[model samples]
Target chain A: DVKVTQSSRYLVKRTGEKVFLECVQDMDHENMFWYRQDPGLGLRLIYFSYDVKMKEKGDIPEGYSVSREKKERFSLILESASTNQTSMYLCASVGSTDEQYFGPGTRLTVT
Target chain B: EDKVVQSPLSLVVHEGDTVTLNCSYEVTNFRSLLWYKQEKKAPTFLFMLTSSGIEKKSGRLSSILDKKELFSILNITATQTGDSAIYLCAHCNYNQGGKLIFGQGTELSVKP
Candidate 1:
């Protein structure tokens, strides 16, 4: 079985505070992705990493950044948390089977 | 930009009813189309369609792709309360740098 775990299931942050979201995959997948899901807008990609130390921006990556220093770890960083940045964040990893396993998700609230 | 659209945005049905969720896409250099089921938190993979006309089935759930029509449909038969969830459709392009453009998704409600 494939397992993906996120750092937090819920987070509360004050405005202008920096936030960090962590994800770890146990399947040693080569591709990892971060997405934020909002009602009516569905899920939008934030960032993705195909390999260690390499990252690519997704559709809505303006307020977010990512780091992948190891094969199984990916981190999403918010430079400064804003009210608009509050949303449910999801992390996923894909392997040779072309299937992506997703983490439970982190619901962040900016106050 | 690659675009994916799914409709009707939401649906309600009773137990034992069959439902078909639709997805259409306009993608450049299409690699594959994927379907996922989101119950509570993260979405889980359901089907990955590459070839047209061939249907992928897993017990009560099935899906088929149409390359010519640029569309796909996921059918769930004999749905139960447990089958109620949001169905998402996404398209993978060849040059998007591993990006998957997703549809807004169809929220399904199955009543017992």
Candidate 2:
């Protein structure tokens, strides 16, 4: 089975603080994605990486950035956190079969 | 623009009742449609439908895609409380290296 693990399950940060959410997949999938899920917005893509050092902006990439220095790890960075950035962040890695495996989401609360 | 839409954003039914969730998509490079069941954490993969007319079944959950209509339906029969979760539908865009466009998701609540 494909295992996707996040660095944190829950996080709380003050306004203007820098935050980082990490995700790692054991399947060595080349495609990785970051998304923020809201009540009505569903899962809006923030950023995605197809290969190491290759990144693409999704629909809602503002106030968010991603890093893929290695194949197994993908990191989402919030330069300066704000209350509006609070949401459940999910990381996914797509396998060769076109199946996306999601990690345990990180519930971020920006106060 | 490519998008995926789900109907009946939320539903409430009894344990013994049956429910159907709808999903429609308009994607330029449609490769397949995927269904996921999310509880409180990660969304678990349920089914991936690429062919139309043919229904995919797993126990009491079944789903079928209509390529010509650009829609799909997931049906759950003999529902149990444990079957309550958010059902998500996503469109796989082959052009984007299999990037998915997800719907808002249908929240299902099965009460006893």
Candidate 3:
């Protein structure tokens, strides 16, 4: 089975602080994604990396950035955390298709 | 623009009952549709449908996709309390390198 693991299950940060969320996949998938899920908004993509050092902005990439220095690890960075940035963040990995394997989300609370 | 829509935002059903979840999409360079079951934390893969009229089944859950209509349906038979979860539908296109466009999801509640 494909195992996607997130660094933190829950996190709380003060406003104006910087935050990092990490994800690692054992499947060595070529594609990694970061998304924030809200009540009515569903899962909106923040950023995605297709290969090491290659990143693309998704629909809602503002206030968020991602890093893929290695094939197994992907990190999401918040330049300056704000209250509005609080949401459940999910990380996923896929090979050639959309059949992604997801990690347990990190519930971020920016106070 | 590519979009995925799911209907009946929420549903309540009793154990042993049957439920159907709907998903529709309008996307360029359509590739495949995926179904996921999310409990409180993580979303788990359920099914992946690529061809129209082909049904994918696992236990009591089954799903079928209609590419021509740009829609899909997920059916749960003999539903149990454990079956309650948020069912999510996502459409993927290679044009975006498998970036998934997701629907709002259907919140299902099964009472025992």
Candidates 1 onward: DockQ, in order? 0.68, 0.78, 0.84
Per-residue lDDT of A1-111 in model 2, one digit per residue for the tens? 899999999999999999999999999899999989999788989999999999999999999899999999999999999999999999999988777999999999999
Report the Cα lDDT for candidate 2: 0.95
**Candidate with the greatest TM-score versus the true structure:** 2
Clashes of each: 0, 0, 0
- Put down candidate 1 lDDT per residue, A2-77, tens digits, no spaces: 9999999999999999999999999988899999999999889999999999998888899999999999999999
List per-candidate RMSD values in Å.
Answer: 1.1, 0.6, 0.9
DockQ rank order: 3, 2, 1
Which regions of candidate 2 fall more than 4 Å away from where they truly are? none
Residue B34's C-alpha lDDT in candidate 1? Answer: 92
* Per-residue lDDT of candidate 3, residues A1-111 (tens digit): 899999999999999998999999998799999999999788999999999999999999999988999999999999999999999999999986578889999999999
Off by over 4 Å in 3: none
Ranking by TM-score: 2, 3, 1
C-alpha RMSD between model 1 and the true structure:
1.1
> How displaced is residue B32 in candidate 2, in Å?
0.6
* Model 3 residue A35 lDDT score: 92
Clashing pairs in 3: none
Error of 1 at A4 (Å): 0.9
Write down the worst ten-residue block by lDDT for model 3 chain A: A94-103
